[model samples]
Target: MKEIYLIRICGKCKKTNILINEEVEDTIKKGYYISCSHCGSKRIFKENETSDLRKCMDNNVYKRVKGKIRQVHSI
Candidate 1:
């Protein structure tokens, strides 16, 4: 099966932070801190965060299908 991933969209500056399946699992396991590199918004990875991540992934898929992939700065 293909690996799944998520990209977190920063609420403040609308930047994206990519999180692989492994990373997402680790975050959920360890309860690690996640921050947006562009906007510096911080949050803990938990159940709610996972749902938000799913939403972000879904939005990305929708944008991709519509041929509207966003461009972000190099990290």
Candidate 2:
């Protein structure tokens, strides 16, 4: 299977390259938004939406397989 990488979208530039999930939450505190590395959009980390997302995988849409991940590698 092909390898897939994950990234959050840039609201301004609309670039979906790489993702860093709330990496700056500690420093920024509760009332702050993370900036996109490419376009500096301040909405990259939408806490409410991303809260229910699984950290092991990137996208919100996923399948509940009984065995291993269907097309994933390295667990």
Candidate 3:
């Protein structure tokens, strides 16, 4: 059976990282690399990567799409 992985889009890079489990899902952490959608820069999220990501939906930090493919978001 194909496992469905929950992914969180990186606000900085817009790169989607498959959420391993509830750890990353419940609370948002920083230090992970997310690819930028513009310059293709592998950027790191601050402490509020989770919250920041949610804000990105409106603030335009990042956008979510229906696929697993990685979309690079640049500054």
Candidate 4:
């Protein structure tokens, strides 16, 4: 199975891409929106939205997962 991360932008703050695991996928699919911890913006991103914010996570970032990340290596 392919792992997926949900990406979203804060409506009020318009910053930060919030990523959630499979556990929250049900709530999202049901039309519930997420709130920003900083600005309390209630927003929801679609399932297919793509963002580079995941690559910038300092703590959870990784170099390679079998093969090197294509875009990061290209740069």
Best by lDDT: 1
**Best model per TM-score:** 1
Residue 32 local lDDT, model 4:
80
Show pairs that collide, candidate 2: none
Off by over 4 Å in 4: 29-32, 44-75
The lowest-lDDT stretch of 10 consecutive residues in candidate 3 is 44-53
Clashing pairs in 3: 13-35, 36-72, 36-73, 36-74, 37-72, 37-73, 37-74, 38-73, 38-74, 39-74
Show where candidate 1 strays beyond 4 Å: 1-3, 43-75
Q: Higher-lDDT candidate among 1 and 3?
A: 1
lDDT of 1 by residue, 1-75 (tens): 644555666666665666666776787689776777666887423222343445544433323435765543424
Of 1 and 2, the candidate ranking higher by lDDT:
1
The positional error of residue 50 in candidate 3, measured at the CA in angstroms, is 18
User: What lDDT tens digits, residue by residue, belong to model 3 across residues 2-24?
Assistant: 32344445565455454434454
Report the lDDT of model 2 for residue 5: 29
Q: Which stretches in model 2 have alpha-carbon errors above 4 Å?
A: 1-6, 17-22, 30-32, 45-75
Q: Write the per-residue lDDT of candidate 4 for residues 1-75, one digit (tens) a residue.
A: 544555555565555454655646676698986677667766644433333556444323236657854222211
| Residue-level error in angstroms, candidate 1, position 15 | 0.9
**Residue 57, candidate 4: alpha-carbon lDDT:** 47
